[model samples]
Target chain A: MERTTFNALDPNSNVGCGRGSGVEQGAEETIFTEQASDDHVIIKDSCDVTVTTTDIQAAVNLQVAIQLAIALVLSVSIADGSQAQKIQQDLLQRISTKQLIRQKTYIENSRGIEVTMTDAEASVSIQLLLQVLLALVAKLDVL
Target chain B: MNESDQLANKLGELLLGDVLERNGFTPSSKRPLTPEQKQQIRTVLENLQVETERFLQHSQRTIRRESKPNH
Candidate 1:
């Protein structure tokens, strides 16, 4: 059995991103992770597991990034633009795609149950926010 | 119908209904939209497409950042 440790995390390492263009840091970006995990991944499976330290970080980073991006869009002056209605519909379409495919998540091996649970909760919150935004947009879409 | 199309249609209908009611029209009235009204709808569609593309890019970037390993 491989031993796992958490002393390799580099908050500045950039994870899987290679000098990525530019990371616009928003408050929400750091809301999930104040510090990156220095954890060394060691999976017990005979086969190599896909979830690594970077994967876990990326997952956390992605969720926050998406949250911030949506928030930014919603906070802009065009918050209630007529197009919002269509955009909301498009978002619904995108969210629905989750039901069409089954993804074998590595969360079980890469992260703890708490992180997985948090992700689920975040997903539900995001969906609810989208739905509420769309409802508001529908009411205002008319000229 | 595909889920995406169904969702798009449903949202479109809600928005369209509001627009029509405000303009003194109804879905069952079978009245054609004026040119200006049509233009407004087109503008909204275009804007949505642009924003959708941008959001997709953000998502792609996130995936790229997460998928590659530093080692």
Candidate 2:
């Protein structure tokens, strides 16, 4: 088995061509060379070539980092069911109290005020809360 | 038993303390809570208590299962 690796770090185009090296028993070792040009093209094994817009490894590493960060945050937050429950309860209570006040006002007045929370608003609030919690945790060296 | 579990336990303690501090529940802290903040803390505590109960129940179930004899 023969393995080859190529790495390029330039905006300009380049091409790698592999040629068979003659050896014993009619076997040949492949030679790989890069051709610099305005258009990048990599030819490997004539039929098994991959074209990438950006560095795939770097992209994969970035994706993994994002996933790990998200997972860490979620796991830390939700690890203790009690804490999660507490937070949920607190949020619900606050929201309910607000709802109650609105209800009372509507009952006292003829005009009705709708207290609706958009998904974006809820998401932002949750994110903010998480960030605050994470910051606190970081300060304590918990993470 | 695992390192991650140990870390999680420590993290839990820290997180609880953080929550309390943010809510001005510190012992030495002399800040008065506004009505809204008080209400919020109460709600959070209530939820936490419920979650604790649920967790205890689940753990108990797991212990029982582990102790059960094979049928």
Candidate 3:
């Protein structure tokens, strides 16, 4: 009878290539090192201001539109007695609510970003709103 | 906060103050203004006040012109 014995040092042995081994260690080291260097610090001196004139312009325009609509409604209601009081009250409440909303939005927007305004544009919008308000008030007075 | 920031803050407070005053905002209101917040309000109010004056003047002119008799 001939006896065959298993040798651990065989080149083709599967025992040495078991589940967890040093080969994976090299790969893990490389991966860990790569990951460690991936996160880079970015230093910034000044942040970019993102708020545009367009935003303010659009908001002002919308306000003007609302004012015009209110004026129109006031004009129609004031022509009739009972409706005048109701319209005036409704308009006042609506304006107060809108002003509150505007204040909130303005603060929120201004908090993070820098807003640049030109004197000309600001003056224009102010003029527009004042005119609309005056017109509406005049109509209300007549009523 | 640098000097520029401080100045800006002051301007903002002034504007906010104007707005609050114009809108009948009281310190006892639900939305109380902090010192910093007041500065912001003041800035907005200042800007708005300028615009409001301009608008009122323009409107007055328009009304006057409209009320004029046709030659």
Candidate 4:
């Protein structure tokens, strides 16, 4: 709160004693509307800053979520279907069958010259090593 | 693990961690594969098996037959 003094009219008015005729005029006016507008700008800028930060965080979160979704889809998409399951099951059965054959042949070899060359056979493994690379580029689009 | 490995592990957890936990995977359990994960893993293994077999068959056919080696 602002303080006011009636001492200008009283004998105790030491500071205002030497003042001119304009000194006794009423109190100065303040434009509350202008001050309110300034306060509004400050509030608006603060809100904008907060909103910008929130938007950036939201965008980052969305990007991470989208990337995760795509990866999840890619990882599981090819393996989701029954057709894929069937292919794998058939292949596993074949591997089991080969393993049995290999085991039986190994046992038989103990008695005589091996009838089957199970040990000589190359293993069925991921062939990452390249003996030769044959590249063919085919236009995949119908156009 | 490197950054990519860490990222992959994080993504794996995001996708399957809860599901695996629900399927009775404990930290101490060996190969605690959930039904869905097991199927996916098997599908991949089977694909690899089939591919290896096909390649082996092709190689076998292309290879020259050697005379019976002496024991």
Candidate 5:
């Protein structure tokens, strides 16, 4: 949709003009071009001028799309920071409460003068004591 | 009797038998532990319990400390 005008007299201009392309030599020529559909264009005149045009609408759209994507990413990251912090705090509080309860129970059981052990607790304790005694017996025999 | 009491009674018998056998005394099936032996066994089990609890507490503390943010 963008239009570009090239002056044939400018040596730096990319417009190409051959001597047989109907452009008069030594006279400044103005060429109006629409959006270029291909990568290469050959314009010829008597002055042997050369020119090129690029699609501006596509480039502008690409820039705008990139900026919008960056803004969206920035906003999401900002929102997630506080949300992640809150979730971590909540999980830590729950774990702390459970640990406190377990510690209290453990202390109470350990401190009792005549502690009564559950079946599973008694089994584990007996197994541990057997292992210790067996190790002692083995050591005493070795000596 | 609770499971721990039964376990303790069984362990006491086993220990008494072992000690007697080591001292060249005949082991008896019905022999009960002396008051002194019972006290010693209780002390050992209590010490083991305390050590286990301390170790667990230390592990939990280490985990909690490491789980926290450094900053």
Candidate 6:
């Protein structure tokens, strides 16, 4: 049987070939040996490689962040759809409820003259109508 | 938010104070809208009314389309 055995004599060398346990921290050493007989070896190989867990984790985190950003943008566009129309309708309804359709009472005075009296609930209703209209215009202008 | 939206927010706040004061309520500030501001607001509202009508019509059409059954 023909046998070949090689041993790496350098342990602290960074030249990609080494033996012993000083090949750098977190490095994995793989050894392969082929034996033709009980005392004869045909081929042998050894390698030391460092595995960077931080780099792999960072790459995974970046991929997750990208997916989250894409999902956020899609959700925002869908949620904002028809938002302007709803805002306009809400402003209009505010005016109608606050000012136009408020209840009032007509009371006869001591001289038999009828007096139109607005309820306390409707006191400030029509006064804020202009402000609501202004806001509605501003919203529609943006749209 | 964009510049226009920021401006609209500030203008709305100012209008709120003005309306409160004019309606016999005490406001946070005493700054009422000037006559020019009032006129500008009125003009904008007039223009927006036409657009609002068109928008409502378009929205109604969209609603009808979405409610229809697919063949």
Best by DockQ: 1
Alpha-carbon lDDT of model 4 = 0.27
Please provide, for model 2 over A30-141, each residue's C-alpha lDDT reduced to its tens digit, 9 standing for 90 to 100.
4332333222222222222222222223323333332333233323434454544454344333322111101111111111111221122222222233333334334323
The candidate, 3 or 4, that scores higher on DockQ is 3
Whichever of 3 and 5 has more TM-score, that candidate is 3
Expressed as tens digits, the lDDT of each residue in B1-71 for candidate 4 is 55643554454334343333443433333222356764654454444435444544443221112122133
- The TM-scores of all predictions, comma-separated, are 0.25, 0.18, 0.22, 0.18, 0.18, 0.23
lDDT per residue (tens digit) for residues A1-143 in model 6: 97532222233333334234444444333333332222211112223322111122222233333233222222232224343233334333433432222222211101111122222222223223333444433422321
lDDT of candidate 1 over A29-74, digit per residue (tens)? 2113322233332222112122312233434443444434333332
Scored against the true structure, residue A143 in model 3 reaches a CA lDDT of 24
TM-score of chain B of each: 0.42, 0.44, 0.39, 0.40, 0.41, 0.38
**Candidate 6 clash pair list:** none
What is the lDDT of every predicted structure here? 0.34, 0.31, 0.35, 0.27, 0.32, 0.32
Better of 1 and 3 by TM-score: 1
The TM-score between candidate 3 and the true structure equals 0.22
Candidate 3 regions exceeding 4 Å error are A1-54, A98-143, B1-71
lDDT of 5 by residue, B11-71 (tens): 6445534543443432121134456644554464455445434432332110100011112
Per-residue lDDT of model 5, residues A6-33, tens digit only: 4443334443333443433443443333
TM-score for candidate 1, residues paired by index: 0.25
Question: Model 2, residue B5: displacement in angstroms?
Answer: 31
Q: Which is superior by TM-score, 1 or 4?
A: 1
Q: For candidate 4, what's the TM-score of chain A, rounded to 2 decimals?
A: 0.20
Model 6, B1-71: lDDT tens digits are 55644554565556543533443332221223446654654564454444433332332110000111112
